[model samples]
Target: MLRGIVEQEGISKEKLEARQAQIQEEASKRFFESASQKASSLETMTLKSPALKSRRRVLDDYDSIALERILGTSDLFPISYLQIGLNAGQSICRIQIRDARGRSLGYGTGFLVADNILMTNNHVLDSLETALDSIAEFNYQDDENFMPCPTHTFRLDPEQFFITDKDLDFTLVAVKDNPSSEKQPTDFGHLQLIPTAGKILEGEYVSIIQHPKGGPKSVTVRENKVSSIFDDFIHYLTDTEPGSSGSPVFNDQWVVVALHHSGVPDPNKKNAWVGNEGIRISAISTYISENYVSYSATEQRILTKVFPNLKPGPSSSSQADGYDKSFLGSNYIVELPKLSEEMENDVSRMEDNNYVLDYTHFSIVMCRSRCLAYFTAVNIDGNQAVNIKRSGDSWKFDPRIPESVQYGNDLYAKNDLDRGHLVRRLDPVWGDKAQQANDDTFVFTNSSPQHKNLNQKIWLDLENYIMQNAINHNLKVTVFTGPVFRSDDMVYRGKFRIPAEFWKVAVMVRDDGKISATAYLQTQKNMIDNLEFAYGEYKTYQVPVTSIEDITGLDFGNLYLHDPIKDRETIGHVIVAPEHIKL
Candidate 1:
């Protein structure tokens, strides 16, 4: 009976053990499932942030194989062509096109190519079509009589396309024969296409010829880098716009590599066209070859005209293989020669756009963005003064002189009417040290409106006089000058600053009583001529140094002036030098 009881207990124990094992398996599976779901949730949360993910994908996509493969060849190298603004008196050709409808539309500009063919984006033609279909009147700025009509017959490349799927948007058209005696075709010449034979390394310099969407269409040249490549397409993180579509992409060699397609426009940002992609020309080389078989003569002619200087096929790579610290993103580059030791030394002390000692005039000035203003930097003169002279009716303090005015809490010119410094602030001083401050000094606030002619002529004389006089006499002069805004109640960073009724400048001297100054009224470009004819007398007058204080209402009482004076140094003070001492 005892043995039977033992056996029954052992079986019950075994059954309980099996139930616990099953429960443990269920718990393990549930834990793993919960962990995976949580991981998925975290990923979804991360994708919710657009700013973080937008640029992130571009960088990552560059690592993919498809992008790497396409940009890896010498056949896919980039080329760039330069563009000059039309306003600068550059030579250009206007192309007019008409579609099935007879209505007129806007015209397009043809970039110079070597062959007889002219090049423009396909969309330009489409816009011409829409205009013709609408029977709209074409508006032109330069030639009012010029109307939109198909002046040149052309053929669109069958190889070109508007891609929606794996879209590589580009349209290549052939140039037609033009009659002689017409406006010379703007055939700057053709550029060699970049080859795609080698790997396009990251951060490579790339440029594009883009058309900006605006009143008059223009070809804008911009440069950037190959941020990433993906699925047979390379993405450029360049600034492009809607009208830039179907433009050409080139590398440093000035060769055409890809056809510009589309971009991601940042609606919230101005002038922001991001993610411009291009159709890899190498990918469709066969199509280009097959379609142009019938137009071989035309293709050859176009090629010859576009690139008279080039032989088709892969060209030598002028592109630098490694990092170039000297190169910036390719939009603009400074190519100024190195400065002299003296200029370099002084520039180091000032901010970018900050004025250095005007050796011509004994004063300092700041180059605020668009405007340039003068500051006082005077010193004591020890020698006895002579050659005191005057030219006007009488040496009197004229408070009404425009130079006597002040603006934005800064008193610039006290008696001098001529706007003094131009090209203020030495950019070289800051090289790389706190560039923003250097840039900020260029603000137009630091500048005053000055007559361009006067700046180049009479003002130039005054500047030279100051520089020569200071150097010759060993005189230390102080100069303070700025602009006079229209409003008396002006704001410097939102706080109100009072200004004088008219603009003027004041120069104080340490030498025996001789004061040399000029003053005049401020006027716009149109009114400058009239103001000059009226106030031109002020430009020739020479007033006493003591008269400056009375006119400007500024007291520099008992202060010794020096160009570079040590602390606690005293130059004896006396009344303004007599009329004879003023030079």
Candidate 2:
């Protein structure tokens, strides 16, 4: 009983009962007072309670039709893409000219057609006919095993030969049956042979067949339209490359039209297909019909199936003679578009061979003049076309910079990467001016070895900033940023090379009464550095954009401008006091 009372039951029943009653009474009084106060406060309350809300528009900005089109289009179009010297099945052929004794004469692939008789360029047949009296030989085969050159040779009938055509590319030969000793000629299906006289309309779809080096060996087809046509020649806008020569061009029906011809000797711009041209079939068809013998049953059957109901088409687009205006100040330079992927790959391979260096894409103009320098993720199109060298006591785009040295001073520097440009050279233009923009564009200090992602994103933003803010205001700016040190081979070096992916962007702006500079050295993924190195603080170093441009002889008027910073200010210039450099 005593323990129960001690355990909160009250020492004694009477006292415990009294204490509990007293506590209950006091609690009720306090509760009533508190309730009254809360009611009064609620009646007098003014501020509203917080609530969730959303904007009215959600799907307004989207284009349903465009989205559907992109998602629904069929993929049949990419099949027809072709390059030169390649065959209809996207394979290359080996022209084997040999004697009856199986002695070899010459070897090459088919190129352009001269007349009705099949014609490979003269260069292809040169070795076979080196000595006219040397028994004429002919052997032909296709690229089956990806070998650089074919081994075995079969004799070609001397009677198969006709005098090669002049002016136009033409070769006449009698069709012959396969020897009992060898496998039958590889069938490339039927080749669509369209006459040049066929309706050559501007903007009409066309296809090509050829084997491209380093790509597919089977016949590949691609489609494109005629950008423009000339009286002397026709220029279509389809993408083509080396080894595509001798490839056939056709209409949608797969009827052969023309032969893939040549490309610009050298290219420096991006996506480097400097526009593909082909040989007109009309120029050589008459000669082929008159001199070459008829195809065998097999050949005839193939042709009939491939070119059913083939007929002459008209010159659809009017001749583009009167419209051939000057691209820039009477310089007869052909206005080739940016480089194509195949061309870029070729240049990259060539650069690996030490034949040239390429850093062609436009980059930021960080700092110019005597002490000019900049950065980018990759130096593009530098030496792929024109020879590039480091200007003495000056700065310009140089293709020979080793990858290591090119992207040094940053943790992410390496080889085989692009040093992209934040600002484009063509963005700035005085007026309706069209030129190479080389003096302004071909500067090295405006680059930074970049990854494909950030280069296309943040770098593009930086370009937009300069273009909208600076150039529009007539304020000239120059920027410079690039990767660290690495190899010099543009192609090989790009494979394993690291990137000073750390973009150290520095911009110099020249405005009224002042010069300004600002910089941002950061990454897209990690806001901070992973290792022990403290993130290099962004430092804007500037003197004057014009002063530097004057010293360097670069024209910055054509550079796009963008100035959206909070306050216009100057970056540090190399201001050595008169006596600062002296003893």
TM-score of each: 0.28, 0.29
- Counting clashing residue pairs in each candidate, in order, gives 83, 131
Model 2 segments more than 4 A misplaced: 1-92, 96-108, 111-117, 126-155, 175-182, 186-196, 213-220, 237-239, 266-273, 286-583
Off by over 4 Å in 1: 1-114, 118-167, 177-183, 194-196, 214-223, 230-232, 266-272, 290-583
lDDT of 1 by residue, 1-583 (tens): 0000111221222442343344324423433344334321112333344432432332323333423322332323222112322221122234343344442233343333333333344344332222223211111223434444323233322222111111222333433333442432333334444223222433455666443442333443335666554434555666655444445665443345555555644445754544556555554342333222112222334433433433232211111111121222132221212223433433312223323432211233332221223233322121222222221111111011122222321322332233333322321112222222222222223334444444455444544454445546755433333333333333323432323222233233435544333332222333243433523422322333233334433333432132122132332122121221223
Instruction: After the best TM-score superposition of candidate 2, give how far the Cα of residue 532 lies from its true spot, in angstroms.
Output: 99
Question: What does candidate 2's lDDT look like per residue over 421-524, in tens digits?
Answer: 33354442223111222233333344444544455555555555554544446443334333322233122233433333333233333333333333343243
Give the worst 10-residue stretch by lDDT in candidate 2.
1-10
